[model samples]
Target: MNGTSFDGLTVVTVLYRSAGMLAETLPTWVRSAGDLPVRFVFADNWPADGCADVVAAHLPADRYAHLPDDGNPGFAAGCNRAVETVGTSHVLLLNPDVWLPDDALARICAAAAEDPDTPIAVGLAMHGGEYVGIDLNPVSLFIDRPAAVARAPLGPSGGAAVLPTALYRRFGGFCEHLFAWGEDADLAFRLYAAGLRTRGLDLVLPHAGGHSVDGDDRLQGFRAFLLARNRLLVAARTFTWPLLLVAVPVLALAHVALAARRVRQGLLRPFLRGVGRGLVEGPGARRQWTGRRFGFGSLLRYLTVRRA
Candidate 1:
């Protein structure tokens, strides 16, 4: 807990084709961000085998920087281009295979500066040592919790988290046509329909999960066609045409019974061409939906919330 306790935090990390896992987790994420005064931005999704000169040869030049290349149509548009070239007011969306520990960015910037409505803090997401199962079910867009479920009301886990930078550019920072998977549950369903409340933090980070296509089989079938067309463009932009016409035919028959159980695990033709390109681009990704009006008691409290 140093560097004036992450004054004006800005940890951001996007780097596609992560050069050998950012040369072994960016120096253990700059020694677990111990001396905090954070500012690490790295958004280099233009990876043609030169991940921004390997993060400017393993980070240094004044607490790391990197931007320029850009053009990588994924990871939420390279985290909205490293939060629009950083000038931090709290950002931390880390990933280069995750590592942080020293105090995990001064306990996630002291829980988003002791929360005065700057909520979104979730961390924990470990990997082989347990703690992963993220589950959110606004009528079942994502759900899989078995490891004796007990984390508490916290859902979306975009690698790691933390927010604010003007509420991530006023909630317009992650839907870049969801070039990657469900785009962090469509940015946590537009930050819970703008009332915003994501705070689950025991502050840990060990991820290493999917180290930039680890053992890639054609980017794992284009990451299952961008997670089956961004889960029907995040359920037609977070439901509500009468819950998206009763949850899009039961989510297209549960994605055709999970593409017939991924065709007996052989992952049937990239899961039926990612469910036929997510039903032909889930209606133009519903114009990148944010019609924010999640009622029905916030969909039964986002399907019985409980991620403490």
Candidate 2:
């Protein structure tokens, strides 16, 4: 692992107003990356905030590709743009707020090197000052009230997800139209629909959550809309007919509870609008991604048993 023999793993991260956190996490990431000759691609969505300065301060300008786009494209788009330039066999969708342990990248790269076909591998995150499993859910909602009904198949941590470049290309990457929220879940479900499994690892990716948006309250309502909308968008596109029948009503139930919660914040309109949009767009999404056919048994196998 210490040798620079490891190759073909590109680390991709989208930076939006993350100069300060980059200053803290960049050193560790740079060290771990170098320990394994890993490539790093950074998408700077907001350049005026000193993100470039931070990169220049720590990493050699030529050591990594610091692609700066001032358009402030949404997170998913920024990541999608960065990924287009990657030539590696696998790409790690890493968040700027996450700082990897010294050997984390080496070990992660080792896993990928051992099995180049590893579909999706996600690490744990630090939330509320403690390590927590990634909120791995394929749109599960119950009277436990708006929570994932089953946490069996754990993974795709908000902090990071490692996926093969081939499968990513075949699946069309994250849906850029999603803009920001639910890209992870959408991709995760699509992977599941294709009979791919998301492997949850014990490695800890220490992430001070919310650094990108700083837990903004104004976004609370917008997030509510996204949470409601993406569930349907995800369900519609990924679930087969029988699974769709089972999922739609539960998705509706979750949206009901979500609308009630958003009413207090005066975000009911956006939430309702999101529902309308999802309904209108779901059919097209389903029709568009129909190139691949998957069986209903895949979903049950993926969501029923935990894979660690």
Candidate 3:
């Protein structure tokens, strides 16, 4: 993909009660977007705190548009809303807490342009200026199969990623039903399944770490619930039956042990309850993926993007 071929790219950010962070992030994005034929879209979720106005003050009228505030739509759903509103060939989904350097956008565009399949390029997210790896969780059965899980990375993630509009349409975008947690991992996995590859850049995307609750507090209970729930749901939809048969129970048992540890660490009730809830609700939340087919060949290509 070349600069001219991929010139028309639109950037979208899903802001949810993040007024202060957007105040700083939007300006950086504006500075980076200079002469790049980029348009910025902000879909502010409920309790918006007037972030749309804060963004408006920073970017030029022609380059920016603040969509009507929508209620608490999940991360993927909010991004889909912005993507639907824009007319660009590619869409960049940025989290409000992330701040990209002035040249990051241009560089990502350059990197993606090298591949003609409208490849999706993900930035290496950093917290306080350290390189962060984009984690890809493997199907549960792969847990004991260390060789398989070793092939992919698990993430404590969500920073910035650029996706082609056609790919989003072809892949049906994100699963809107996944309220918030695990949405990125779910999307990244689906992107891989749809013949679209994902990679973490060597360059870092500066961001203010976790958004769940506290910096160190891992939302241990709630996150355990979401991960247990969503990972199972994702595996069923995307994995082969053989892989599913192995991964599912092994992962559940691991969850049981991890929950026990959390209990010893003083969260027994919530941890145990989360496990139960995940077990009951997870399988029921089956997301049928009827999107495109991305076989092993595309996965090989995506792996090479890391070299690029």
Candidate 4:
């Protein structure tokens, strides 16, 4: 709210057993938050990592606050929960593993505030100590490297994006149904549907991927499920019912094609099973498959909420 300048910006982050990283990240913010009001809020979904004490010990009383809850709620819920407590003009939903240089967070806030009509601004996510730029189609985030960053249309990155709390609330935060994987796409779709703009900023923030979710457990399969479910939800809400009907065949064939490819690689069983589960359980099932949930309801609202 510093009139497009870096003044009072609050940082919100959701933690699911990622406290160790917080110890390293919070100090960086504390040292560089400047005169700006930056709240390093931590929402402990389960507190399995003793995050409360970890954050409390490092984060100053005036600068950080811990949300009261436990439940290991999914990332979307955790982010929404964090947004509720933010009273600042801007909110940056950050990840614990994200290592911000002293002034990077402040700069992103400043960049976002430059336009009063700014709805959302995203920063580049760096991994393995390099800078990663953003692109929308097929979604890309550049990593590692000290160089110039560029702003462009990008598929949303949940980490380190600055957004006005008003727009965020109006959009109803993230669709809780997504749980994880597709929430970014779902949110991006809503922002686009509602006639708002989202910009990707040229700045690098380090991200340690999979530090929280174990890779060997076939977490990607769960990601695939959410992606499949939410992608259908987006199509159902955004397209006319008839158009959605037509699109289904195309999408189904694509799924089959992908499944066939995966099968050839000996990885189709879980992917196919997840896809089947996604079809039976999401808003898509009622609308595209039967038009049940679509009967006498706003398509957008109806599709936005629901277990998928």
Candidate 5:
């Protein structure tokens, strides 16, 4: 790890039947990273469509590597696997659906150089004109939302986030068991507990929003279950017992609010099943993230205001 090197950055993006979008966005991403010594890594979650071809067509052979993983291992797993191939001091997790600003990614790397303690630097996300920033509120990311970190003090945009590769690995990357939705929360909460702040940069990233799973019939209602399941899993994995006691009621209400949306989508069954799965699986996951907690009492004070 080139701990002090601002010149190196690894842009990790996990692909899921995203070749078309990858092709569309690749040029801008490359241009935005101009002369920045960025290692572009694409982890293919759905390889049948040849995301490799898109990368090969757009980038020089030495600039990128393709990690083929099938079985649709889920976003959390893909992100973790992709991060493994990183050689840079800082890692930026880019989603295929997002259209990066020509300067945003580079500026984020520069910010990393300026403020080494933040570890994580996030670009604000705008999905269809909405400003969604990094929300550290464990409960905030769980609810289907588009709120900003400043506004909500709660929701996070996992897609356009940048962090040092060391802290990411030290906290144990994304919780692979989360498989999808709340993994970002799982990691964010853990980092917050470890006394790290995720700074939101002053850049707006445009998102094409849910390109992979939005219309996929196979994953219908799957995100809902994962969101619900990971909500509890995150609580166990990152919350101190005291935090859990105070958080349970707030988290339960958040679940109920999300449940109403799932019900409307006719996903009540899977949603409920996920809650049960979370209860069954949380304790095992707890062992992986418990050592990082500083104190929930301090965390409560830090919850609403994380210095940007």
Candidate 6:
């Protein structure tokens, strides 16, 4: 809405019991934003110990707002709620565990300014001192391996991306039905079908991945269930029935084998439960097909090529 400038940008981040990470990352995030006219909206996903105090301590009262406690509704819902609560020209959906470099936001804004029509500008995610791949491969339903490329020809990494507020609202934001997991891919497919491009910026954001639910078994199982369920739901929502006829079976078989391997590692129950839930709930999940479909050429390229 503001022609790709960072004049009115709201950085939306969902906090899922990430108080410690917030304390570490927020300062860097604020510093990286530089002098851009920016505000922050944080959605707390019903943390056992509330994060309000932590948020307030880190961000000035006028610079940030925290959403009402709404019982762990998941990342997609939290992000959607944050987007609705803020009135800004652009929105940066960020993970709480990510620390931005000083020049990251400037780079993103510059990239957005270069192509105002592009709906999304993505930054590379770095973990353990290496760039992590975020591009989606629809055929395989996997993150594409890194390749030597200038921009993402596929999709943006949901963890650190800047999107125009207008386009985000127009596209209805992320799919809340997903609850968590695969919603990024669903949004990416929708953007791709609409002929909207997601450009990748050279900026890299350091992410300490999976710190929120790192050691909790129950949380891990629940996350696994959502991941499996949402993976199928995304496939169902994005692919044509004919393509699904082939792709679904392959996906199922692959998941089953993986689950079996997990079973051997004493992780059977949760893995099987996830597979079962995915099979049952996937069909009932929301369908986002809007007449536009991924072209065959893109499909072929996706199968044959790896993106960096």
Give the whole-model CA lDDT for all candidates, comma-separated.
0.68, 0.69, 0.61, 0.61, 0.73, 0.71
Ranking by TM-score: 5, 6, 2, 3, 4, 1
lDDT of 3 by residue, 1-308 (tens): 22325547788877776777778777888889888878888877754487867876887788876775566766768877888888877777777877879898888777656653444434443433443334433433212111122233322134466666776666667777665666666666566655444544445676775552444344555555555566666655555456557667767777767666766766666656655665675555544665533344544554454432
Model 1 lDDT per residue over 72-152, tens place: 767888888788877767787877887766766776777777772454545445454534334555434764333345544
Clashing pairs in 2: none
lDDT of 4: 0.61
Q: What lDDT is reached at residue 139 by model 1?
A: 38
lDDT of 6 at 304: 62
Task: Report the candidate with higher TM-score, 4 versus 5.
Answer: 5
lDDT of 6 at 151: 44
* Tens digit of per-residue lDDT, candidate 2, span 1-308: 11222257888999988999999999999888774657888999988898888888887765678889898877888878888888887888888988888888888887777666655445444543433223433334311101122443333543477777766777788887777777766676666665566655557667776676556766666666776677677667766788778777877787777777778878898789889989988988787667443346765564466433
lDDT of 6 by residue, 271-307 (tens): 6776677677766653455545554545555556543
Ranking 1 against 4 by lDDT, winner: 1
Give the C-alpha lDDT of model 6. 0.71
Which structure among the candidates has the greatest lDDT?
A: 5
TM-score of every model versus the real structure? 0.34, 0.85, 0.78, 0.76, 0.89, 0.87
RMSD score of candidate 4 (Å): 7.5
Better of 5 and 6 by lDDT: 5
Give a tens-digit lDDT track for model 4, residues 1-308: 32433345678888876777778776776766766667777778868678888877766788877885677678888889888888777788777887778878667666765764464444444443443322222111111222233333323457666777776776678767667765665565555544454555666666776667655456655655555555556555544456557666777777776677667756676666666666666564334322122221333442343211
The total number of steric clashes, by the backbone 3 Å criterion, in model 5 comes to: 3
Name the regions of candidate 2 deviating beyond 4 angstroms. Answer: 1-6, 129-155, 263-266, 293-295, 306-308
Can you write out model 5's per-residue Cα lDDT over 242-300, one digit (the tens) per residue? 87777778877877887888788888888898888988987897887657653566465
lDDT of 4 at 10: 73
